[model samples]
Target: MSEALRRDYRVCEEIGRGRFGVVHRCYSPESGESFAVKSIDKRLISEDSVDRQCLYNEVKVMNLLTPNPNVVQIFNVYEDDIQLHIVLELCNASDLFERVTNRVFSESEAVAVMLPLMEAIAHCHSHGVAHRDIKPDNILFDEWNRLKLADFGSAECFREGELMSGVVGTPYYVAPEVVAGSEYCEKVDVWSAGVILYIMLAGIPPFYGDSATEIFEAVLRANLRFPPRVFHSVSPVAKDLLRKMLCKDVSRRFTAEQVLRHPWMTSGGETGSVAVLT
Candidate 1:
């Protein structure tokens, strides 16, 4: 298998490392196209059984959503006794976290970046997959500056009317129900996306604390505020959508599909040709 990979492509420098594997830059000698190869050591998987399951689950979800412009594209999978290799579309421009860290995005810019993401998450939900984690780091941009949602390690499929109770996700971006260990639906991803949008526009998270405990408490209370310093210039429609997305009541929160059609999203006139799912 190693010989096959070496023969077909030139595997290059490491680009990313996660709990499941290390991602490396690889180029196909024939096509001259670049791709990412995630190498997960079988030994590491043996040590933590769940890690292997997560790796396979990520692959399953990525494969299920293939050809979607807003989701990372997985090309092939190579496996042997040593490790499992999954080839993915390389986003040379990097993830949204880096972009957000470098500069504050205006409301228009935030909407442009988020519209596709909203569609991607909606598509995932429509297919019964829930991306338990939806933060800036999981959102990536390709060479064309097109946004793609990545990292499906925490994703799970739910039947109709199913509820998820796992306590997962980053503290600051987690939904109130998730923080309280209550069963949650795919809308939890909407809450997290709302947090990302808040950070993108406001230049900081809506919820914060000195420690995880305090952050969790704040999340449970779900007291959201858009202070004037950040939101002063933001349009009222944008704030209204933000409020809907961040609503503490799951029933009131906007689903990803609904968010894409919100007046603010449609009225911005900044949304590109994103393939929004119904």
Candidate 2:
């Protein structure tokens, strides 16, 4: 742990661990509040390596997007010769991945989760930041049960009309355009959010395979289907929204803002009079 971090906060037991570091539950004596400190071992990473760049990028992106309720807030950063410690809001509840694996969510429950998620994504897009990696693992819940989007290791900044390239997301949630290695926009995050929605309702990813290559192939095919067995109870409005989100043609895909306005979302999972887009 960084001495500066230790001087400022009471770092406690490990709460979680990730690729480059471990997250510890910490307390700020000044505010009488608890937080998380993600400590990264600098010795394990090279100065000029992609891993080091990603660490810096995550901090930059999070700094740009903080103060939004749905997005995890970064409070402080501490660095020393051996480690880098980031102080962040502590979210005690399990992440979306653990929640989804435990049980499928009803449309109403799904709406509750997706609403904040879309809000976060919309906020990111409006600020010209693309959260290239938006998956269940990165969606956390605070003690108040508010959904908080975490992790920005793959985030990038972009202009409104310009396109970005380089595939940079997980297999199951990657957008079709990304799988095709074609230039894409912030809408790629929307596609990943759509996959999360599908998994929340159906308890399985819409696209699946035994390997990364196979998964990429499936994503490129973009053959979206709702197995009657799992989706029989799902609402048509929700299904329509999914189709719009997971559309292979990026032109037809729903933007984060558009998704927020969709009837399925606006109505709190209840059916509304708005005509479904084809």
Candidate 3:
């Protein structure tokens, strides 16, 4: 723990460790409150301009989206010679992946996840910020089990008519346009959301391969398949929403706002509408 961080908050335990750095469960002795403090090594980021820019962008975007309930909140940022400490709302509860990984999510269950997820993304898009990375691992559940979006390290801000070109995103959740090296917009995130929904309902990714290279190739082709055994029990409305979200054509992909009003997303108690996956 950095001495600067320790002065204000008592570091209780190490909660997470990743390629970037460490996340500790901390408490502010002054306020008697607990929070998660993510400390990233400055040298690790300063080595690459893109990495440094991403770190700064993450802080900017998260701060902008702070008012949204479904988005994680960043309370403060502290820096030292060797590290940058970001104080964030700690979700001691399990993440989406850990919560439902091996289980099948019924239409209602899928809605429970997608509705809030889309609402958060819609909020981001309306504010001209694109959460370039969206996946199960980035979604966290609090003590009440309400889902919240986290990890904005890859997020970018853009104007209404602007286009961004970058091959940034996890291989399994990447949009086709991104893999094709085409200038894309916020819709790329919708593609990733579709992949997440697919994983939730089918218990697997729609496009999968043995390696990252193969997965990237599959995403480029955009040949999404819905095996009957896996998708047989999923609702038609749910599948329809997924098809629109995962559309190979960026123009055809459903916007986050549209996704919020989608039938599968709105029809709360009607979980019996099954999709015919041929």
Candidate 4:
């Protein structure tokens, strides 16, 4: 543990763990406030390694995108000889991955989730940042049931009209262009969000295989279909939006702003608040 961190906050038990660190539930005794602190061990990462750079990049990106309701807010950073501690806003509720595993979401509920997510993506894109690794595991819910997009480890910043080249992101949520190793823009996030929507409504990913390579093959194919057994009840409007988002041709792929403007998202419905799944 970092002595600087211990001096500032009362770090508690482990709440989560990741590749290079463990997350602890911490408390600010001064204000009686709670927060999550991700403590990364410096020994595990080399000084000139990409992993170390990503750590710095994640902090920089999160700081750039702070104050956005849909994004996780960072509080403080404490580094000692052994570890790096990042103090962040705590989300007591489970993540979207856990929630989806329990039950399928109705169209309205999916809309509620998608709206805030798109808004967050739009916010990121407008600020020249691409959250290259958007997946269910990173979609968190706060105490108020508001969705908060977390984890910027794979995020990158780009200039206007510039393209990013990287195979970053979960297999199921990666865009076809990314799979093809082509240069991509912020629209890649929209594609990933579409995959999340498909999973939310159908309880399965649109593309799947027995292995990662096969899944990548299916993604490269970009053959999207809604099986009657699962999608019969899903609205055509919803599917239409999905098609636009999951389109293989990046030229036709819907941007985050376009997705928010779609009929299904704009039609009569309560989107300002997300559904509190039981």
Model 4 global lDDT (CA atoms, 0 to 1): 0.91
Off by over 4 Å in 4: 268-278
**Residue by residue across 135-160, what tens digits does model 3's lDDT show?**
88899987888889999989989999
* Per-candidate RMSD, Å: 4.4, 2.5, 2.3, 3.8
Q: Candidate 2 lDDT, tens digit per residue, 132-242?
A: 999999999999899999999889999989999998999999998998889999999999999999999999999999999999999999999999999878888899999
lDDT of 4 by residue, 1-278 (tens): 77778888999989899889999999998998999999999999999999999999999999999989999999999988889999999998999999889688988889889999999999999999999888999999989999999999999899999999978899999998898999999899999999999999899999999999999999999999999999877777788889999999888999999999998899623332232221
lDDT of each: 0.86, 0.92, 0.87, 0.91
The weakest ten consecutive residues by lDDT in model 1 span 269-278
The top-ranked prediction according to lDDT is: 2
TM-score, predicted candidate 3 vs. hidden true structure: 0.94
Give all TM-scores, in the order shown. 0.93, 0.96, 0.94, 0.95
Instruction: Order candidates by TM-score, high to low.
Output: 2, 4, 3, 1
* Total backbone collisions, model 4: 0
Residues 17-79 of candidate 1: C-alpha lDDT, one tens digit per residue: 977578899999999999999898887667557667778899999999888999999998888
Residue 81 in model 3: shift from native, Å? Answer: 1.2
